[model samples]
Target: MDTKGIEQMLSVLRSTATQASGNVQESGPANAGGVDFAQVLQNSIDKVNQTQKQADQMAEKLAAGDTSQNLHEVMIALQTASVSFQEMVQVRNKLVTAYQDVMNMQV
Candidate 1:
């Protein structure tokens, strides 16, 4: 229904992630930019969460017998959201583990 909303959300998350990772320069004299990893990660996570929310809504609609949409479309959206959430979780876990490992290293 709201495909454009999804596209915008995805783009925001991408730009945010790029900025957070210090890959994109925000400050440039003429036309260059850089990304800050923190901001990027935050934005990406927010977008992913929003996507998950949308998926949840779709699922709800389907469950309520509002069969206006195809089941495959709903399922695909749900799966995509699930995978994104899981991937983000794994990334967090890895970051935490690396941090712990570094903390335990010899000074």
Candidate 2:
């Protein structure tokens, strides 16, 4: 339930949206901000995986009759994981489309 992870995911989604719309700047080095695109992508995927794993664990605990686990919290965690996963899928689709567009272009 770390807010920072959520923020990072949102930022990744936003960056993907910007790239899909061809709004990315080309005035300087791509990694001028000292951020490695591959690392960011890996981190995002890891975050999504972690979120899903956590949700699964929470659901299992609830089903196992753990009285300390609240039903509402588990439901919320499941929903969050679902939404994050969907967002990641959309980002992947956009990246694939962008790559295709680049590859099909005549040099």
Candidate 3:
């Protein structure tokens, strides 16, 4: 459990939320800033994947008699990964529903 890494991740999410709400202004196009919506989404998914992998590894290590890793930390990591994944799924569902609604709209 890297506190610095967790803080950095949280900051990224906060900035992304602010940007999405139009509270933050970019000097150029999203791609130019290297922070477009697609990129942000991809980064988030990647982070979630990394977290899941880390959690899995930690669990394995703990199971293998690794005394450095604590059960509480491993459990927290697992729960965080699970919640992040669930949130990503919900976002995908919302996107799908929005797309369907748009398609069903009468011109």
**Candidate 2 error regions (>4 Å):** 1-32
State the C-alpha lDDT per candidate. 0.70, 0.78, 0.72
Candidate 3 residue lDDT tens string, 1-107? 33443444445556755765569865567637443555656676787899999999999999999999999999999998898888778767866775576578666
In terms of TM-score, the best-performing candidate is: 2
TM-score, predicted candidate 1 vs. hidden true structure: 0.64
From the highest lDDT down, the ranking of the candidates is 2, 3, 1
What lDDT is reached at residue 34 by model 2? 44
TM-scores for every predicted model: 0.64, 0.73, 0.67
Give me the displacement of residue 8 in model 1, in angstroms: 19
User: lDDT of candidate 3?
Assistant: 0.72
lDDT for 62 (candidate 1): 91
Worst 10 residues of 3 by lDDT: 1-10
lDDT of 2 by residue, 6-101 (tens): 455457656756766779856467646644457767887898999999999999999999998999999999999999899889878877876787
List the candidate 3 regions with Cα displacement exceeding 4 Å. 1-35
- Per-residue lDDT tens digits for candidate 1, residues 61-99, read 999999796799999999989888887787678667755
lDDT score, candidate 2, position 25:
53
Using TM-score as the measure, name the better of candidate 1 and candidate 3: 3
Model 1, residue 38: C-alpha shift (Å): 1.4
Maximum-lDDT candidate: 2
